[model samples]
Target chain A: MTDGILTPDQILSAAQDVLRRYGPAKATVVDVARALGVSHGSVYRHFPSKTALREAVTQRWLDQAHAELATVLASDAPAGVRLREWLGALFRSKRKRALDDPELFATYVSLVTESSQVVEGHVADLVGQIRQIVDAGLARGEFAAPDPAATARAVFDAAVRFHNPAHAAEWSRPGIEDDFTALCDLILLGLEVR
Target chain B: MTDGILTPDQILSAAQDVLRRYGPAKATVVDVARALGVSHGSVYRHFPSKTALREAVTQRWLDQAHAELATVLASDAPAGVRLREWLGALFRSKRKRALDDPELFATYVSLVTESSQVVEGHVADLVGQIRQIVDAGLARGEFAAPDPAATARAVFDAAVRFHNPAHAAEWSRPGIEDDFTALCDLILLGLEVR
Candidate 1:
């Protein structure tokens, strides 16, 4: 491999792959270095430690999620349609990633609880996007919520809770998504054109 | 202690304490026997193995939760009021039991995933109770929705999600119960009249 300068994005991509393969606990800096065919010193120069590497990987995942969500939200669709489609996409992505790679999913859930700052930052951004949508809808008399921020948080929380595979087996039978969509519809109903 | 005849309830109570203290992995038949001041043989007579004892403890916990909910529902209060009051009580109970007793909670959560029958039984009972309230409100033309069962499930899911300390922190700021009350008020708003 050429000794060309490795970009932070490349390092982040490699770190994500390692984390997806081995859990955060087992994914070491040396492992990432080995994956990149680089020296431990080279990986350390960018990440400092395993914790730093894990944080970077988590941030990268969040960044990607945000970008994907932005694309969906910005699509030329009605607010309700966009919201439902975005949630369906998000849930599907989470399900596929979790089923395809349990280790990474476990590590991400652990990080959400352990690294509050990183998780909170990501949640704040997601919540902000939801608030913006809700606010715009309310302004146009398309929704009727008194507090868009709280409603947005509730919507996000419900989506996360409903889509969790651990809870999925409990909620999702055949046509389970229908029930979830109905719930979202009711929440949106509370904010409907009045 | 006398060599008294122990009921299944007695056995479960002793096992619950042991599981809460030592966790399912560490709480063996011998440990539970010792905690109950009974012979290991006695415990073995009731539950052939540690797994059996743990299952009994979990079932007992679910039974207790169901009993509490039943009592609330059987009260003369209006359906909406009954639900809100019962849900708040349930949230407090779950938080105290689940968080304060992590070992027991871990065992319960793990057991639900491992044994779908156990989770299904509990979920069925919970859904039934929720359906009763939602149906009652709908009969009175209080709620606007046509699907009472789905609405009930959403409320149940929301309550469970809110019971998690981390998630509840989002709304349980200073005077946050007011927010929760308001949310509930909105949910049951049209479903009942003052």
Candidate 2:
């Protein structure tokens, strides 16, 4: 109903709630504007296009997950432990979203389906987190990867079974935790090779 | 068309053709039977249920891929080369399947989605193949993995992006080949740590 006063961040925040209520397919800019009590033109002024707004929401959702892992990455734990915890955190975070809020997770999955670039950016951010842990390990002489960034990528891809949305169904099966730990150990062993 | 003369193999061959022609969702046992000029009863006799028939077709499809890689695994080449070639073959095989026969591959993806057990068995077979290669490498003192089976699983999970149908869209992205090679090199380094 009003404009000029509501920040773009506030509109995105309101859009997320509208998105959750309406779901991705039905959610519209006017609905987001209505939720924010602002004119549709105001929402358009901030995002320029509905796609941009949805993408921003996607990025915001991803960044929330990224922020959780950032804490682990920034912690002073040993690099190896930090690496393990970093990956564990990512898996748990995704699983929580999937299990706790299935509808919202479905909405995000739709958003990701519509925009591969969002998933790519999310993955890039994850790899960057892993790289930090790896670089720390290499500096501490606890790991021997030739390229920290490449190793970060390999580690991320290797654990896709547990974290990748595609294989989410498999994550709930019995003994999956064991599989995760076993793979992590193998990677850690490979990382610790001196 | 005579029940006494028509072998199960012939029925399966016709089923493959019918599945390809109609796609999995519309394809039926009667269609398969009709294709072979036999009664649906004959098809039902070989496969007790439609699920069983679809599963058998899925297994048949997977076996084709397995048979190709089995040759690489069973070769007399060094284990390192064999492992690299084995992974390369798997990625290439999957890529070929995804690209060469999009319809059949889509049918296979749908089948796998319906039957997790089939996918589980396929993964087991692949992990078994990797285990054999790892065991051989360890025996020859070319690799140092403590658990060849677990290592094989790690390697399989790591290279999943290249092989998993869910990530088919990303496989065609520019620089994906480099990403594959980089990850493979990282896994190889981990395996070769002595």
Candidate 3:
């Protein structure tokens, strides 16, 4: 493809592929350009530096989960059911990526470590989503949280291991599913109206 | 002092000091030996290798917390109060290490990464302590848990960010104390008999 034909989206897609194949340490903008049949300059035009490229890809990867969780957030189900679904979906989505899509997941993890701001934004976004869920639960009188925002953050902190990429190593351990369930069960119990 | 003047406990103390001063990458058996006025060979005779020394230091650091927490565990206080104190003390101990003792905390984090088994044993030890607390709560009809062991593990998992070395960077953030309290409040609510 010609230089002008290379869009940021196209570059990001190819960058993701290159990152997955070579891992973050080895992958470069030049490799991404090579995969896309474009000059490295073209890729640079879209993303000022390789760091920007990696950050964009990490953002894109997390955005997929954001969208997936958004569905659970907007569902018509009761707050308790929706909260349960949200927690399970978040855990399952990450666990699946870690176990079944190992390469891309590894790439995502590396990109995340390099892009602290991106990870921070992703975490804030996830916390905000939880806030909305808590708000809904409170509005429906299904949950009791004296401070919804703090409750939201507390909930995320409580369940950090199951969904945080840093804890991915523990996901595949035997009985982790049970552990995850038990933790979530405790969290949900904590959130319920008592 | 003779060559056999050194004991593993003494060597571990000197190693911990060296690790705190220079960090894991820079600290070595030689530094610990020099601190003790002995040859590195003497330190090796007790610790075997630098990795073993690091692990021993890490274990020692954790053992301090274990001993402190064991007091809370063995207290005649009600299970709810003991659990609350245990969670708060655990968080406070780690948070203090991360914020107040910067160098040693960094060394501990690095040593933890190198000494997974030691960390695992510490976690299991903590969970076992939590189990005893849960068992007391169950016996006194102060808590409701289908599986006491799972409840203990879940409690540990819930407050992991407060104590886990991986989250040390977040220890000094503004409002973190409130976050810790909020999470513990929620966790205590979860453990309550409703």
Give the TM-scores of the predictions, in the order they appear.
0.83, 0.93, 0.86
Kindly report the docking quality category of candidate 1: acceptable
Q: Model 2: clashing residue pairs?
A: A1-A37, A1-A38, A158-B158
Could you give candidate 2's per-residue lDDT for residues B34-119 as a string of tens digits?
A: 89888889889889998898898888888886677978987998888898899889888888889888888888888877887987
Candidate 1 structure quality by residue, lDDT tens digits, A1-194:
33368767778888878877886667788887888898878877888887787788788776664466778778866777777777777766666666676666667777656687886687688778777777777776677666677777666655655554445333435766776676676566655664
Query: Model 2 residue A137 lDDT?
Result: 89
Candidate 3: residue B37 lDDT (0-100):
92
lDDT of 3 at B138: 91
- Winner on TM-score between 2 and 3 is 2
- What are the lDDT scores of the predictions, listed in order? 0.68, 0.84, 0.85
True-vs-predicted CA distance for residue B23, candidate 2, Å: 2.2
DockQ for each model: 0.33, 0.63, 0.71
lDDT of 1 at A73: 76
Candidate 2 chain A has its poorest 10 consecutive residues by lDDT at: A185-194
In order, the candidates keep a fraction of the true contacts of 0.13, 0.50, 0.74
* Chain B structural similarity as TM-score, candidate 1: 0.76
After superposition, candidate 1 runs with Cα above 4 Å error: A44-50, A163-175, B1-4, B26-53, B107-114, B163-186, B189-194
* Candidate 1: residue pairs that collide: A144-A191, B142-B190, B142-B191, B143-B191
RMSD from true fold, candidate 1: 3.6
